[model samples]
Target: MADDFTPRYGEVEQMAPGIRRVLARNAGAFTYYGTGTYIVGNGAVAVIDPGPDDADHVHAIRAALEGERVSHILVTHTHYDHSPAAVPLKAATGAEIVGCAPLVLDDNGPRADAGFDRDYSPDRVLTDGDVVAGSDWTIEAVATPGHTSNHLCFAYREGEALFTGDHVMGWSTTVVSPPDGDMADYMRSLEKLLERDERIYYPTHGAPVDNPRRLVRGMLTHRKQREYQIVALLKEGVKHIPDMVARMYVGLDPRLTGGAGRSVLAHLVDLKERGQVRETDGEWRLCATSARD
Candidate 1:
């Protein structure tokens, strides 16, 4: 897989006059541009979503530093590809890592992909309103947890440019992977961004978006359309995530089908929570409506 995998390398681009975005090139299951790293202010740079554990990628980042002080490494989430490299990068640059608190363990157990290394733990946990300052620039933390519970998006308050991790992208819709990824939370997070007036969004993967609110609305509409399609499928006798995925994502990539199932399951969970559907004994069905039997 590694050999076949075309590493989507990253290049540095300016998001604002002082903010530089490093777009990664790894564009597959393992790494979507790896992670979009940002350098803010001169000599006081901040790296967002440190990306995968690729030595070359890390080296590229170190190269990009080019004598500028790397002051902070901010993680949008703790997925292996995005956060694991933060530790080594921190070691190399002596930058303080920042992110959300760990997940809450239930009686069932810690959620899938929850616990992260304390070594990679952020020097400071970023809350909804915390600010990371560069030379003269400031990146405000926005708690946009959807792709993962710990997900955070950093916004440059000056130009209203947002560093959107997996929450939003220019090339593709993000995978709402479960255990940590929730459709309801994701929808809310989308709405959160929609309500904002950000002009540009630099995502962890792919190119930057110019009109983020429009893109957010488009994503929201797509989700709603998918939800309705799933509901209709259930009404017509499709009874589980696998079935809905098979029917809805016909002729799609087999590998991506699993991720599709995760999104479908998230929709099902949201529908059930909304009293629009119900699941029992591994089967799913629509709730009784006034117009339907």
Candidate 2:
């Protein structure tokens, strides 16, 4: 959970035993420096999360694997910043586009990022427990549907690493926008990771997460605390989302207000679905069953 990552843009740097990461040039609030596209294995490699459609990043990925065969272009999700490069990379290497199924939900107020990729047609869509292996390494699909309904985290057998897409991040909590981004499913997915035993997590956005279970536990607690805060506010007669946002987040960045509202909405949806809260004519209030929670 360190923010001291140096993006030597378009250069591949060794992370774990069989994992090498290349940073894309696209940087912003969401993408820490840029997308961290990973290459697994030595001779016949599998590229994980080929980032945005930057020609330079694509060329750098191809350059790094010079004289090597790209057996698979494994994608974690179909966000614009994550899966767009798979097209050119597959054309460049003839590798099959495998992993998360194509999805474009009603992304109305879900996220503030570059939006979902509607044209993300994969060659082979993987379900949970599905495996794709090369001679040197193996990748397993983990169906974690929070950030997007089709999001997946690929586990590497040789390196003991999980390629977390946007389900979890080292720098920030994932935005659970509505429709496709369900808070209940997201929380369930986080709990699912605690059942695994991976050494490290290589998220597509930020730095690698060491002691992933600890971070995951803290994330769960933080979300539960958010639920408490929202319920407390509802009980105190603070009805509007913007007012709740102003109260919960002090000195928050002005740019992230919209995303913060979306997150708050996600939490509210989760609470309402759990029968702890109810919304009437755009006004939310504590439900009769709130005391049980």
Candidate 3:
């Protein structure tokens, strides 16, 4: 699907009945157009993922909420672009910060960027199935810890739409960087979403996913293909992440090789845990059982 949605920073665009999006000015390789800060409902509202800590972005959120009371500042995760502005938003509106706890890192995982908001502490920690109610909106928390260990996707009951965060995006497949992200958990989370009946999804970085199930299935299939490719490469004597990425990602952009390597490492770690592969001195090899099965 073509991404035709162009975000206008510092301006409010009503996406649906009560949901408004204010795009931040910060845009980059990871963040598609920009960080989408969603305001759910009027009068008494809930601001989700208050973008970065840019003063202009914070002022824009406050301006968007003019004449309205912010009851909750919801965070999907603590990624720098996703949750840093919660502090300023909370201070400006006196809204309670609600979402997952701080990120938990795995020391043995691959070297990846840990750009998290270290100082962020949610006023209320929401577990799976917890609900945050507003006057016109009621958001049910769905714990999806794959993109990050503390990530949460909120389901807006009124619209039957899910705020998917980075777990599932419309424009691109989510990057699962291990240490903070787990491939097994990420796949399990995708399976978890299949059991729900949400028709639409509002992701943090791109256009709304109209066909939630189709997008999720595509994502799962893509991951499975990558895993299979990795296994095939291991069978061919490719024993390291850099070699696997080189063989798997043909004509990949030079700038993205680092991220691709990290993703390959995440898959390797998951495969090791599943007993399909084994690692010796950081070199990976397919197991005999994997070859037979």
Choose the strongest candidate by TM-score. 2
What's the TM-score of every candidate structure?
0.87, 0.95, 0.95
Off by over 4 Å in 3: 1-5, 104-114
lDDT of 2 by residue, 169-252 (tens): 988888888867889999999999999999899999888899899999999999999888998888789988999989998998
Model 1 lDDT per residue over 123-148, tens place: 89999989888766788999988777
Q: After superposition, how far is residue 164 of candidate 2 from its true place, in Å?
A: 0.8
Model 1: worst 10 consecutive residues (lDDT sum): 105-114
TM-score of 1: 0.87
In candidate 1, how many clashes are counted?
A: 3
Which stretches of model 2 miss by more than 4 angstroms? 1-4, 110-114, 291-293
Residue-wise C-alpha lDDT for candidate 3, range 68-134, written one tens digit per residue: 9999999999887888899888888899999988764443423232377777988999999999998
Candidate 2 — what's its lDDT? 0.88
**Considering lDDT, which of the candidate structures 1 and 3 is the better prediction for this target?**
3
lDDT of every predicted structure (CA atoms): 0.76, 0.88, 0.87
**Candidate structures ordered by lDDT, highest first:** 2, 3, 1
Model number with the top lDDT:
2
